[model samples]
Target: MNQTAGLAVGHYILLKDPITGNPLAGNPRKIENIDVATRTVTWGTAYAPVNVTMNAVKVLFHNAAFETFGRVDSGGYLTLADQAAPEGSPANAAWLWSDGTSRALRVRTKDGITSSLNNGGTGTVAMGDTDRTPAASVHQCGVIVTTGTLTSHRLLTLPPATDTDAYGKWIDNTCTGAFSVVVRQSTGATVSVPNGAKAYVWLDSRGVTKLM
Candidate 1:
């Protein structure tokens, strides 16, 4: 019974009259607290103190994307990567590089932390030395153009276990050249995005899902 309201802070919700099956008069209340486990919401006037079933509340969602890479849980809160950049340190980013020997993609974040990019499997990819982390969020999403001849295919890694509901996609930008952009799962599976193609790779409770 996943009756929890997938709402965020500062979002407005309409409170309905439980008995009449209609919105309560003057009942467009601002959401203050959400209890997912209990599927309850505590909102409305502080002086009045109203609690209601989450399913009865109508929520308005604002469209937005993450400005920083982190873990976004079911509650919609973000937990940024733990690494830190020194003052005046050059902003950095990382990339997913394919390792032929290991047959996996290795990821290195901006903070110089190196780890295997999970391929939705048991094996971990070998790490590459190149720093592929983008400097800003605006540069995060979009087509990536490679500079030189690609030795091995580059992959876009999926979010870790913490970001179970989140997914990522890579659009192959090359028009004529046969560029290989792949989505590497943590479970050791690989899905390729052909040149001039795009695919959505997401991880859910069930497993890694691909939407081409």
Candidate 2:
């Protein structure tokens, strides 16, 4: 359960009220330590100590630093505490978040990464002649397959990059008929990918670049 909250000053995540999204109303106790192994949280100090056992719960991250990412676990451990997902007993569940129109979870499912533009699947985007900038899911994809025939030298324009954005996609011009997809970026030079050839497009601080 994701409980959105204004970022505080530290990495301390409030243990939400079991019944409400409001911070656990009490005499404030700053968390000083977290032991993932023992599944215990310790606050206060040696003289006035406090500890509580965590039963596999997801806590909303609070702090101005996390305003962009919103929520996180393990203080950016970026690793699961347990083994694989769907552990017959433990059942490592994958988390999902939504705020922007296009964002995806990197967690793997039963089979593998899918190529669907819907449901935030990390996959491919099938484009026709008129498609300009592909969706974020397609930008995350390793390959992009076009299926349309453009009248002129198709301008495969890409979107501008932001601080939180970085992606690369392979252009596979599998469209009907023959028309070159001119991969161009606003701040960088352009590369015309032949109808039957491929080229890699990625973003850097200076903007998008193509690697043929």
Best by lDDT: 2
lDDT values for all models: 0.47, 0.53
Residue-pair clashes per prediction, in order, are: 17, 1
Q: Any runs in candidate 2 off by more than 4 Å, and if so which?
A: 1-127, 162-165
Candidate 2: C-alpha lDDT:
0.53
| Off by more than 4 A, model 1 | 1-41, 44-148, 161-164, 168-170, 175-179, 185-188, 205-208
Kindly give the stretch of ten consecutive residues in candidate 1 with the minimal lDDT sum.
Answer: 121-130
On residues 41-151, what C-alpha lDDT tens digit does candidate 1 reach at each position?
666642344665454334443343443446878999755443333233334645444444664445555645545444331222221422232332212333333232334
What is candidate 2's CA lDDT for residue 109?
Answer: 26
TM-score, one value per model: 0.33, 0.41
lDDT, candidate 2, 77-187, per-residue tens: 442232222223223333323313334334432223223334434334455566477665464456666656676577666666654666676788765556687766666
